[model samples]
Target chain A: MQIIIDPYSWLLGLAGGLLIGLSAALLLIGSGRIAGISGIAGNLLFERGPDRGWRALFVLGLILAPLIVGWLRPELRAAAPTVNAGMIVVAGLLVGFGTRLGSGCTSGHGICGISRLSPRSLLATATFMAAGFVTVYLIRHLPGLA
Target chain B: MKNLIGLLAGLLFGAGLTIGGMVQPQKVLGFLDLAGVWDPSLAFVMGGGLLVAFPAFALARRRDRPLFDLAFQIPTRNDIDKRLIVGAVLFGVGWGIAGYCPGPAIAALSALHPATLLFCVAMVAGMWLQRRLMR
Candidate 1:
């Protein structure tokens, strides 16, 4: 499939960031939750209360929205990338572990944390960006990986 | 009122993933491969995100309470401990290897991408394991 650069994509990207920021903001305003993926995911694991329903719903909406959009606009559907199952699993485990240790994921730290201008968040975001940079460098340059 | 805002926010976020071309793992992989044919598009996406978010955040901070509620709950801990560094490394490794971070991974699920499903399952498992270890 030929990849075409759609200028509309930029508008969508900007809109998406606004939505994420808005969601984080609203979650804080309404539910008093941080919309932090790790924290929300963690609550689903450790807590079995009524709050779980909203978290579940939020996640469900996240999963369902793309499908609904794709169904409406067939052009939106793109080929899935080729990656081994083992790699996928390892990657997931690593992210989960990182979230717990970091006390938040990208949404929490990069979005909500940074928004609030918390010193911890600043450190966390820097760490997050730096780590991403290193990983990309290693994967692309290292032999037998790319 | 809050739920409505949350829903709208989510819709926008979903649209952003679609438009940012972030839904495509290959695009992300390209950005990751700095030594090779690196695509600087993701940087633009990030920049665009910051462009929209930075001002909104600044404005929001000035308000004593959020539009619908009381004070913002900010995490107070500032210590750069072992957990912080190790977790970040792990996250980077995952992102580098899989080309999907948590937010985008969830977004990818809507596309019914197989790799995304596998990644999500593994992520959940990792979360469980961390809880166990922490306990």
Candidate 2:
């Protein structure tokens, strides 16, 4: 397997990952909650409780952080994806359904759950990551899929 | 104060995703497409998150409740069940297809891209459908 090597991106990835970890850590310490983005965002729609405000605020911050960055660092402005919009919407729907059914996503299970050594999250993370790998293979290799 | 912490967490998480380049579909797709021009950057990003989180969770186990809250909301179930696997499979396929999971998608909503907006709408609809039909 050919490894794509780029030191700059590696540095960014590690820094970003640490930040993500720290954010989860903060949430855990402050509210005793996992920073699974899907669960936090989904709750805004399906569940109603006094706890909704924090979740909403968390989501709002997630949505707006990039804008704030763009305002501060014009050079770090986000680049737009060029994929077909219809396909993206379908993917989004599937992701939404799957995450709700699965009970978490990358953040919840991948980072927090795995770090805490939760068995369910571990299984879920393995399954999803494998599925992701397989899906990418099929999408890229299969004649009709790509 | 609790909500403020929540907001800070969100802000930091979003910034991490941005800086980590998780917000870009191409970057994510590169990471997933192992057979293609594979990108291992995301692995580093996830690793970075885990590195800091490990000790924090260690600290978490010592506390019965959060500092600003009355109780902890950590998951307690240990069972690896069908729902978890099947749901994850579906979610993975979707993530592979779009390169935008829930977090980045939400973050990208700030960009006001039309298709992503459609995806978010559809995602919410799918979530609603799951609530109505899956239970």
State in Å the error of residue A1, model 2.
Answer: 3.0
Q: Where's the lowest-lDDT run of ten residues in candidate 2 chain B?
A: B111-120
Which candidate achieves the best TM-score against the true structure? 2
Which regions of candidate 2 deviate over 4 angstroms?
A: A73-76, A79-81
| List of chain B TM-scores, one per candidate | 0.92, 0.97
Q: Tens-digit lDDT track for model 1 on A1-146? A: 12435556546555656556656655665555566777776776778875666666666666566666667666654335467888889889998888887788777777777766767766776786677777877766668865
Best by lDDT: 2
Identify the runs in model 1 with alpha carbons over 4 angstroms from their true place. A1-12, A29-32, A72-75, A78-81, B1-4, B67-71
Q: Name the best candidate (by DockQ).
A: 2
Provide DockQ values for all models, in the order shown: 0.46, 0.81
- Model 2 scores a TM of 0.96
lDDT (Cα, tens digit) per residue for candidate 2, span A2-104: 7899999999899989999999999999988899988988888889998799999999889889888767766555554566877777788889999999999
- Residue pair clashes in candidate 1: none
lDDT per prediction?
0.69, 0.88
